[model samples]
Target: MPAAVPLADNAVRHADGQGHAARFDAQSTCAVIVTHGPDPALLQQVVASVVPQVGHVVVFDNGSGGVDVAGLLAGHRRVSVMPSALNVGLGAALNRACERARELGFLHVLMMDQDSVLAEGMVHTLGAALVELQQGGDVAAVGPQFRDARSGELAPFVRFGFPFNRKLRGGPGQRVSCDFLITSGSLVPVESLVRIGPMDEALFIDNIDMDWCFRAKRAGLSLHGICDAQMAHSIGEQLLASRVKQDGVIVHKPFRLYFIMRNRVLLYRRGYTPRVWIAQDVPRLVLKFIGNALFLPARWQRLVFMCKGLRDGVAGRSGGLPG
Candidate 1:
C-alpha cells in the first residue's frame, strides 16, 4: 500500500508487540473503534465480535473515566487500545484512529460504532463486496444492512431520486448506488479517506456520516450497502415506545437534539450535499420538531436547544453546544 497522510497523535497504544510498525498489503483491513463512556459489558461484546474478523483492531478510549479497557478485554492478542484524558468528539476520535490505522500500515479501515455487534462472516461479506466493487475504481465505501438492536427493524438503504428520496432494497455491487450510509459497519479504503477527507469534526456527533457521504458523492465516488453483510446495531435515536404518533419522526435527548439540528443546518449549507437531500430533510425536520414538541420527553427543553442550534448553525457556529 502507498503512504497515507499523517493521522494519529497522543493516543496511548497498549499491548500487541514490539515498539515498531509493519506495512500491510491491500488485503489487510483494520477495525478502528471509537468509545467514550460505553458500558464495559457492551464494549466487550463489541470487541469480541470484531477481533476475529479483521487483521488488527484499534480502540480509542475518548475520555471514558476509570474504565480499564485493556483489562476488560485482556488476553486478546490482536487488540490494542488508545486511552485519552479528555473526550474528543466522535469525528476527531475517529480521525486519530484512522490515522493510527494508516500509521500501522493497514490498507483499509473499518469504522465500528461501540454498540454495533457484527454477525458471523459480516466482515468477510463486506470485504468481498468491497473488493469486487472497487475493481471499477469509483467506489467510495461499502456498508452493511443493519438490524436495529432496539426494535428489531431491518433498516433500508436510501438513494436520492427525483420527486423524492428513494429507499433502496439493494445496494452497490448491484445496479443501484446508495446515497449515504451510516459510519458504523462500513468498510472504507484508506486511499478513499485520503481523497474524500475525514469526518467533519465540526459536526461533533450527528450528521457526520451524511456530511462525509455527501462529500464522497461530489467527488464522483459511489457508496454501497451489501445485503448479505449484516450487523446488530442500535441507532442513536429511539422510537417512541408509547402512543406517540411519531410517524417516522425520531427523537433524541435534549442535548443530542441540539447537535442534530445544528449539524443538519451545517450540512444544508455545504455545496457538496445533494439538493435532493436538502429538499427532503426540511420537512423531516419540521415533523421531528413537531413530534418532539408534542410527545418527546422534556419537550420544552429540547425545543429550546433545537432552536438555539438552528440559530447558531445559521450564524456559522460549529463544535459542541455551550452550557
Candidate 2:
C-alpha cells in the first residue's frame, strides 16, 4: 500500500466563522476532482484551469503513483489534496470529496477529471444555468458540452431512444435536457446528491454518471446540458485513424475495457436504470466487444478480461479488478 497522504494542505479552509448562503451562485461552487495515476502535466493543467473559477478545489488522489500532487499545485491557495493509500474508486472518492466540500460551506460541486480542462467561464455557465433551471423545477445536475482537444469533434449529449439514441447538439445558449451527462465537467448540487443518495461505489469507475443520473430521473429530477459551456476533455487513451469513415474511435486501455463490460451488465440489473437504455445499449456493447477484440493491440488479453468481466458481473461481483 502507498503511504497515506494528508487530506489538506494549508489551502483547505476549515469550517469556522465562515457561513454559507442558502443559495449558491457560480463562484460559490466547489470542484471535486478524483484522480488515479494521472499524468503530471495534464493534472497541472487541469488544476490551473479550475482554480480560478470555483470557491474551493479539492483533489482526491486515489493512490496515484507518487505524482507529487502537492508540488504540482503548490502556489494555489484555495486548493486541497486528499490522498489515499488505496485507489478507492471514483464513486467513493467523489462522495468523500463532496462531503468535504459541504462541510466547507460549498452549496454545489463541479465534478471534474484529471484529464479534462474547463474552458473559460464554463463552471460559471453551468452554475448559472443550474440556478435558473431550478426555478422551474427540481434540477439534479447540469453539464457542459465537452469536445476532443485533439480532433475538433464536439460531443453531443445523449437521450435514450428505441431505434436510435437521440444525440443533442442544440444551438449556442440552449439548455438541452438529457437522460445522462458525463461526470466530468458537470455542475451538481451537493444537496441534490444528498437526496439522490451517494454514488454506487461497488461498480467503481465506469458508468457512475449513468447510475446517478438514472437515480435522479427516477426521483423526478431533471438533467440539463448547457450547449455553450464547453470543456476540452480527452476520452480514451488515443484517437486512432481508420478508413471506415475515419475510425473516430476512442480507444481506452485494456483494463478499462473490463470495467466497461462489467459495469454495463451491472447497471442493466439496476431498477432505476431506464429499460429503454438497456434495450438500446445492447448492440453498442456487442459491437464494443467485437471491435476491441479485432482492432486493439493485446486483443487476446482484452478478450480474456472482457469475458471475466461478464462472468463476474453475472455473479454480482463489484469493486476493483481481482488479480
Q: Highest lDDT among the candidates is held by which one?
A: 2
Taking all chains together, the TM-score of candidate 2 against the true structure is: 0.91
| Sliding window of 10 residues with minimal summed lDDT for model 1 | 15-24
Candidate 1 lDDT, 1-323, residue by residue in tens: 12322223222222213321122232377899998878888998998888877777888888888887767766675778888888878999899999889887776789999899998888887877776666665678888888878777678888876556777766434534688899999989787899899988878888999999998989998998898888998876675455543223354678888888888888888887888888878887887778777877788998898899888889889987677
Q: After superposition, how far is residue 166 of candidate 2 from its true place, in Å?
A: 0.7
Error of 2 at 261 (Å): 0.8
Point out where model 2 deviates above 4 Å. 1-24, 242-247
Which residue runs of candidate 1 sit more than 4 Å off their true CA positions? 1-27, 171-176, 241-249
- Candidate 2 lDDT over residue span 209-277, tens digit each: 899999999999999999989999988888977666342888888898889999999988888789899
The lDDT values for all models are 0.79, 0.83
Model 1 TM-score, all chains together? 0.87
